[model samples]
Target: MATTQSFFRIQTDANLQSMQVGSIMRKVKSRAWKKQRYFRLQDDCATIWYKSKKAGNAHSTCKLRWLWKPPLISISDVEAVREGHQSEVLLSIADEFPPDRCFTLVFRGRRGNLDLVAESAEEAQSWVKGMRKLIENLENMNERERLDQWISDWFKKADKNGDGRMNFKEVQDLLKMMNVDMNEHHALRLFTMADKSQSGTLEDDEFVLFYKMLTQREEVLRIFQDYSSDGQTLSCRDLEEFLREGQLKQDHVQQHSMELIEQYEPSDTAKMRQAMTIDGFQMYLLSPEGSIFNPAMLEQHQDMSQPLSHYFISSSHNTYLMGDQIRGHSSVEAYIRALKRGCRCVEVDCWDGPNGEPIVYHGHTFTSKILFKDVVTVVGNYSFKTSQYPVILSIENHCSVEQQRTMAQHLTRILGDKLLRNALEGKGSDLPSPEDLKGKILLKGKKIGGLERSLDGVVEDSLAAEVSDEDDAAEIEEENLHNDSIRRKPKKSKQGLSKELSDCVVYCKSVHFNSFKHSRIHSKFYEISSFAESKAKKHMKDAGAEFVHHNARQLTRIYPNGIRTDSSNFNPQEMWSAGCQIVALNFQTAGMEMDLNDGLFTQNGCCGYVLKPAFMRSVEKRFDPEHPEIRDGYRPVTLTIKVISGQQLPKVNLKEGSIVDPLVRVEIHGVPKDQARQETRHIDNNGFNPMWHETLTFTIHVPELALVRFVVEDYDKTTKNDFIGQYTLPFSCLQQGYRHIHLLSKDGTSIPPSSLFVHIRIKEGT
Candidate 1:
């Protein structure tokens, strides 16, 4: 068990501290679906519980106003709190409820947003400010303190009687809720030991001790003993040896050791003597520095001053769809989600609508439609929230000149200074860098003529040029996607562009791809080509070197083919290898492909742009991803990982008495030669403290482009393995030595206390 005390502390505002007395507010799902519900923050300050009408009628209120239920929202799960009619759901009721009284709780993960309308604006303000404060508090918590808070919240949940204490039966129920199926006899023995009062129940402090006893990692203790000089703590020299030998810290080893000891060692005596206790060592192992991903890559460390073509941009296709392309709902919430996830390029399929307005949706489909103005409004507001880099609005214009003028007006009015209206003056053929275009929005669509025409001048000043058949191609792709037997030639001619909309295309002029040589000979630097995934794959295979050289000079975007109606994604690495800058995926879909995309952009301050590798950026290199050995600065590495054990893996099934048989899978995604997969044997009938003790090795040839994914799944012989949690990162960001892989839910939110412990070793020249 942990040392005799708990280390949990929460600093709360005076208003939140007095929140035991809750308030009543209207919970709204849609314009017609609004109900009054009582909401209250739990005493732990980590959960917000609201009572349903049925529960309110049948159950008596507890000390708090809300009923004890499973529908409570954790404070940490809230991604953002937006005021006014921010969401499409909220904006629909703009006439019913005033903007000042409406607010939305934008939850992380796949959970739907909670729209609420307060009786007064003051009530809405209080909740928004209060919820933000609790989120801030959770964000500021250290690892230990966060664990302590988690344990506390569990304790509150397990105390079914609301008596401030949990009996043995209640503790058993708590164990199941925490995703641990432990041996009953073993659990009782530990429970008896923790109940020092011999009262057969655990108070808050006793529960903390019990948690420690149940979670004590003998594997970690063994490592600590191996490095400890006197069996109690590790001296500075001992730590230095561990850092140099095991962690691959070649320079300033002694300094790194001392800094870790001074920062994590809780005991003043230990800090003064330059020693690390077991607790301190474990704490250090769980900190960000000891995380599986390298902390250095978490900042803006890459050079961003290069041309726009010299980087990979995180992009989203069909940015307004929340589901399948044929019949999905179109909402502004999709744009918010993409932008918040550091997406720099988003596609909008604009078609003519009523009132001279342009609407966004897949054409010739039953998918719902949303106003283009609303989409632009959200983009203007949230574009720079996650990344200050430029956002490319990939426009698929199927609108006439009249509605196109309205679309142009909305762009200039709603986006204002954020939109790049005027073309860069006298910049030759080279496009600008992301660094130079920060906080700007660039339209990616047809330009009627050259970009020299003034944006504020007359709409008739620009020359009209026939737009490409890209929109026609889109219709043909959809037709082929649904009916493979029906093959029709794409309509050759399309409507010309409106000069008003054409002026907004400062850069990223969409052009049809004929050939690489044709582009090099005739295309300007600002011009770009959009390719369907199948077409891009053909070029990557047929002319890999030429594709790389072509991308080294101008921007290329690869989007998913129309056949993926389920909104699935192609492996982005395939396009990245060809040096394609914008490889658009369905951001609403969560899968391995998006995981790798997130990994690449997560570094470099998560600014949506990552610099292309040196070999891919050089026109002289003429690199081929299919032949990595020929690339410059190709250094392979050997990654060795010991699948030591798991700590409290989340159960995939919530069915009563259901337990997980967890297995760990490690995968490497990169150039063809470097891709590999290895997994550990499943541990049966245990989600808590399952030890694998297996080792998996991989040889990553192109380390710069490689991504390592660690996954946990529940084994089931009768069906497909159910996913539990996973963490993925760039292979170069993998840190050597003992570390913890903090797992994430399928929707990419941290699943606290669900993690894997492993010892990593990396050596050069694999």
Candidate 2:
């Protein structure tokens, strides 16, 4: 069956200078055992042995030969050995030495002898040189091919579909196995680059190109250059090597010697821009030779610390240098920059623009313009790390309800599948979708008790548009709207917390309602000069921050444990009995205040007097000295309010059949002198009472049965225009016989002495 007998031959001098070619084959194979060896060629001075087989196969056949003419070394082997040697430190002679002159090649276990092709020694040497050169070239090409094959193997493993190609999904899963995390956009970007044909999959040749691009140094030149300074090579002392070694150097290790070795050589910052993740670098090596390689991947070196180097920078603008020179920063840059700096949460302000697009801005009304949708555009296009996209986009919506919903839809449309789909597909179908993110997103809206709007519609709509093929598609869209609405009814607060909060708090109270004398006194010590005191408070609470209130109504919304409260007027003992800790005191109170009191400070936690040297001494005497009741603290008190009266509060109704818009009118009143005095002086200190008589009317318009609330809290409270008695107001109306509001904690405990419970019924034709 076999036309030619295949075997291996060993050659040496008559003096037996070498015993076996087995050792040489073993040495060559040792370095790349994980890789397959499809071809092996071994040669001695007078004889040659050759083996060829596929990768992953252990057995190979060998043919032995002799020179019919004078033998000469081939230039191909010379080049192969030369290239291999130069690429590795261990194979130092690979490039520099001639393989024919150095050693012989043979098969490990094959047994045979060979026919002679050359006669004279000189002729044989010349013949061997020529043949060896040809063989060397073949080997060199094969080695390159072998590397390409390795890349193909990796691609196939990642493909998962056995399609001989890989998509973004497959690459993503493979990256996970390698402990390399990549975002869907980034993964797709890389996959698209490797796909070449744009087939959404990578073929073997594409895979080979990818493999070559990844391992090749061209794309990662800048990164590697960054790690190496003054042309000094990365060695055992480098952080990567040290991490691999897992050995810590002793403190006594000589810094002088290391420095003398050019460790102190200035590193080029420009070069650092060239660096990329090792994975990215490897992927570069897999790229096709002629294709344009995007070196953008090697843009940051800051996160490449000691052990695991996972950071990749795809563009220059998204990169943050070691110092403050942000590459491409606009006013919107701060938000994204914060994420690059590793902030887990960020504050974003949103407003409805003339175009009705949601835009980001810190100002209010159209006069202070910033588009919310623009912020989304910047973020979606310019994320540094895929995971960093999860960083909270804290939004403060200072607009009307319809506008707010429209803006939310605007965000959905802009971010769309690019941002939401990848995040959703990566998750289980059983979980709630984007609709669940509505209230969870920490957006500021008009809700009295910090009510969370149902995100079911938003989530269902987002998911309805995009779903993975693996998911059940039949009933998804059909059930989305209806099921979402049913699932979306405002989640009632657990136990009695929601009910209790409803009872005590007023939904719409203003600082102007407090007395002028009290307000003046309050204004003099701190600065709460605005009638819209609750605006900042609302925003802060939405950001998941804890707000402390000076009054019971403002303090009524504390639902979580870690948030501390310090009341100035309420019975500290009574509040303590109500599970509140820390009693805060007001500095505006004339005489001696209680000791052990945690004094609430302003925004910077620095007494306003700190900005001026003249008042510093008085501040020091009152606060810095060992005062009995005043302790050190810097928490700001926040207040939330709602308006309750409309018919009296104005009431209108719409039945399932009737056509009348529900109307309610609420008057916001500033705190008066009596209430201020009562709060400042002890409640038992004579008949001092604070009354809120001045009213500024605000209107409420909502669909029938819409559970609406107006949440107010103070973010910037100063002593200047301070409101005394009550701060927050909360109310909800239903066309029924009885109406009541209650206040409860984040846990479920109710605070007594909330607002008064009222009952009302209107006749058909009043």
Candidate 3:
């Protein structure tokens, strides 16, 4: 009971207390599909337990709430609580309920958002307010406290019979769900030890005790003992040695050692004695400070005053599509997701819609449409939430002059001062820095004869112009090739540009890419060009150095080829190697290519802008990634990563006979010379504590640009391997020494209690 009590111990407020009473909320999936779901806050305050079926009405309560199994929304899993009619899903049911009566629970990763409507607005506010407070409280919890809460939640979930106790069979089932494939005899032995009452069914404290024993990390104990002289407590000197040798903390050895002792040492006596016990050592190892990523690099540490073209901006192509290119739904949710993830650049394909408004969707396709104003509103709301850097709205305009004027009006009205209408007062021919244009949105599209206007600041909407390139050139061609809905049509000529929309283009004016020499001679700093994947790759191979020089002055965007009907992403690393600033990828897709993009922008505060190397940024000097040795600062690095072990590896398949056979794959993504991968042998029938202790080595020719990806896969000789978890970071962002690489789920969200212990050694090669 005490063990379980610890899990439910949070300072309960009025909102949480009221929520415990439960409410009858209508779960809205679509306009036609709305059902009453009984929602109640679990006693732990960490979960919102709801039934899958309807609750009939508000008066009738769930008889046995705890026993109402599965599909409960864990608070930690929720990314944000979107209130009002904030999403397209909620907007569909706008007619049935008032705005304040509806809210959406946006989950992390690729999980579909849960849209709910309450009987009254007050009920909705209570749930939203309560859920938000819970999330905030969860963020402030220590690692140990979070683990305790998790244990309690699992106890509630695994107690299938609702007896507040787990029998041997139930405990076995819990183990399997926890990603543990343990031997029956061993499990029985531990279960017997924890049953101090000698009862066949174990209670709360007993379950907690059993969990501690089961998850005892022997490998960590071995490492701790290796550093501790007494095999118990690490003295100040001993701790300093560990920091210096293991963590590679050379300068602040004594200072850092004492700081860590005070931070992680739970015992007051141990802290006073300047010693660290086993528990404290474990706590330190699991903290974010002990992560593989360099702690100093976590914040916006890089120089942000550099020109926008000097950094690799995190750009997304077709930000409105949540699914395949042709028939995917176009919703405001896609815009929200991309902006919330620190995407600095997003593409908005606009066309004429009902009521003389502009709509965003994939042109010439069966894709649905949402109002352009809705997309702008979402972008403005979430633009600076994750990052304060400038957000470029790559406008793919296919609208009439009236609708185009409406698009510009929506941009200025919805985004307000955030929209950069006029250029910065002090800026020259060179593009402004991310710092200079912080919290602003820039338009990237075709304009009528550029930024030429009369002295009175009057612009004519009658001025018609043309741009040589269509932003969705490939997609439109493919749409024409296979337009079953419409007859096969000729290649559409370039559409006219609206002077009103063109006036909004402060920076990132889209233009056709002819050649590197022509761009260098004719292109202005604000004029940007887009290239298809094939053309970009050809340019990268042939005139790589020249492309690097061109990008140093002007912005170059690379998008996936039109033939990719499945909405797949191209490898952005090649374009990045040539210093292309905006290499847009399909943000909805996930793979090694997306992994590389995630890795590169993970640092520099994850501000969606990573500054290029000095060589690439320099005007006189250019770095041809094709010939790495010719670079000015060509300090090659030899990286050695010793894969010690994996902790709590998730089960790829939860079938009775299936246990994960896990393997680790370490890939280096950079210049051709630095790109390579090495993997370790797979372990059989173990999803828990699979030890490899194998080493993978690579010589990165350009460590500054290289990204290292650590992947764990469920190996299958019979079929293709299943992805388990992965973590990626820039090669230079690696913290030298023993560190834990916390794994991320497929859609780049943290999967807690899943990590790999590895020792790293990076040395200058040649």
Candidate 4:
């Protein structure tokens, strides 16, 4: 019996050695002490095993908690891995044994940095090479390869039986992992469908087929067919006709058609194909090589040092609610989604909740409530994930003094050093720039005893002095009657704010608006005023130049008026033209206004901040959106776009059978006269690759203030045309020559490879 056990133990040790690249005795700082651990790199992941101290033997049991896998293990996650590093006292295990010859690995995670040391330089070098190779391989994978790898990893986890098959229970668990919650009956039906042999289990191939079914884009294929003249293919001549006039006199149209056919057709063919098949069309639509979003446009090399007021900030109103403000589900997901989409300013209406904690919700409404602490935690984690620009927490305070203090504590503790506690530039006379406040959170709300004391005191004293000067007896009687009437009306009183919470309002101290003249004299660097849409519009109409000049220096936030109960959005371009930085919108709603907002900020790297136009930024010049032709250096420009072809256009309705009548609309939004729109004639039954070869042209006076929007809609004789997909971009960013316009869903997510091929030309006009 002893001989048999010895043989088994020898075999196990041999197998372990063969599987590992290298193993070494390392002192790892697992809590406080430096314990000797056996570290090894095997199968792309690093494992640390605790050495048994009693027997001085390496154990097979590993510290499973220390294993790192892909998606989490990225090149950016590793800070440094050095060989022959000098002993660092801070991370060293013992005082006597200096780590001069040891290999040190430094990695960063959610909590903080972690350091691991190897016993010798050779062992460290081996581990570092393995880890570096793994990270590089993962990062270099294309989108399709990455998706395949993820699917394979998920399959391994789901196949619990170890026989390459999953039962109904396992399949249900897989769906849960995919975040799909289906009824038991539905899940059973799906399982049975995948289990062709009625064996009550799914094989590996069957599982893959099921996954493909879940991810297949039938709508895209249907739309492709809608564009094709023949059921199987789309002709290049038709494509050319859709992009330009059918006349043969236009040389550019013929050149564009030949170039597209050569680019999209299969190269293996003996001769250049005049048409594209479904497979060729689909591949062209989904590849990133065909993407229209220029990578150079998203580079973060722009100067972010301008004051917060100098940039147009992407702001959201009622950010806690996902639907209507009156009856919506308030969740931290709203804040997360908005921040991840590069929104810099988010509104949080805090009201008193159970216990001393405050909760965020719409007051005097039926909207659901979320804990304020949870919202802060989400903000702390995701605020800088998408963009390094500063975030503004627009707090609408309705909490009591104690609850407000608790809110402050939550912000300090959860945000830690990320919160901006004081002026970034030592209380300078001017507002600090966004660059100076990067990775910091700013609190914007009312503060205690921070109102204009001089203005308030003077008004109160004047009223008292005038009242004391009443001399005539009959006048006294008349004054008494007036006083009785005034006493009958309810008087407004100011509420006290907690000093602890008040100190957090260093820059964006919310204040009430008086008049244009008074605000000019009283507004300070630290104080910003909010105005409703109507009020702001009235100011612009009454004094356009003054309002433009005021916004050049002071920060003004314009929100939707009370009448917009449906949470609709105003045309942000009007406010942007006037240099208003924060044009807060109802992000939950989707419409033309939202499209314009998304387009304007799509430039400048989509950092949620964009530099104002030169004329709007200049203090000497006064520009008006309504009269752009009067501005100096403004000239008329003609834009010609050829609607040539579409690849994998999405069907507007899944239930409208397999056929669709698709059309392309060219919308030019700018000053009233320049806002011209036209749509091409709808093609019957073709959805896959449709060739219109029609050209549309427009002359606009102000290209700087114009947004060019490409919309794809499905025609229906019974009702209004349904929207399929759209792409919007600033006219300034439009590239000349033949280019593909990638389509985006209504919610601003890229629908891969679905694109419109067009030839765009912009020429200076009269």
lDDT (Cα, tens digit) per residue for candidate 1, span 18-42: 4445667888877778888878777
TM-score per candidate, chains pooled: 0.93, 0.20, 0.94, 0.61
Clashing pairs in 3: none
lDDT for each candidate structure: 0.84, 0.27, 0.84, 0.66
Ten contiguous residues minimizing lDDT sum, candidate 4: 464-473
Which tens-of-lDDT digit does each residue in 1-766 have in candidate 2? 0100011111223211221121112223223332211111223222233333233334533543222333322222131112111112223343533333232221111111111212233333443444354444334432233333234434545877665566766766655543233356765766678787888776666765654443333313443355443433443244243222211223432442243223222334322433233333222222221011112212221222211001111111101111111111123333343333332234344444575555543231112333565556555543433222222333333443345566556555655543322212432312222223221212211222211112221222122212111012212322443533322322211111111211111211112223333542442211111211133233223321111122211211111111111212222211211111112222112111211111111111111100111111121222211111232331211111222211101001122221112111222211110011111111111011111222222222111101122111111234322111121221121212112333222111122112212222222211
Superposed model 3: Cα runs more than 4 Å off: 1-4, 52-69, 452-472, 475-495
lDDT (10s digit) by residue, model 4, range 1-766: 1212222232233323432634535454433655555444333232332332323226645434333323233333454454443223222344534455355444432122334566554555555665555455545655444445555556666878677688888877776554344567977866777777778887766776666555444544564576678767657765566345322225586676566566655544512557766555545444443444444565554578777777889998888877876677786767866786788999888888998779998765678888899889889988998888899998877676678789999999999889998765454776788888889999887654443321221122122111111011123233344443222322222334666777677778776667767877878867777877777788778877677777777788888764464678898777777778888998778877888888877777678988776777666787776677777798889998888877656665555234567799999987655788998988776554666889999999878778899998888889998887899887876765456788887766555445787767778994
RMSD of each: 3.6, 34.7, 3.2, 14.8
lDDT of model 2 at position 683: 16
Misplaced by over 4 Å in model 2 are 1-344, 364-367, 385-389, 417-766
Clashes of each: 0, 140, 0, 27
Sequence-dependent TM-score of model 3: 0.94
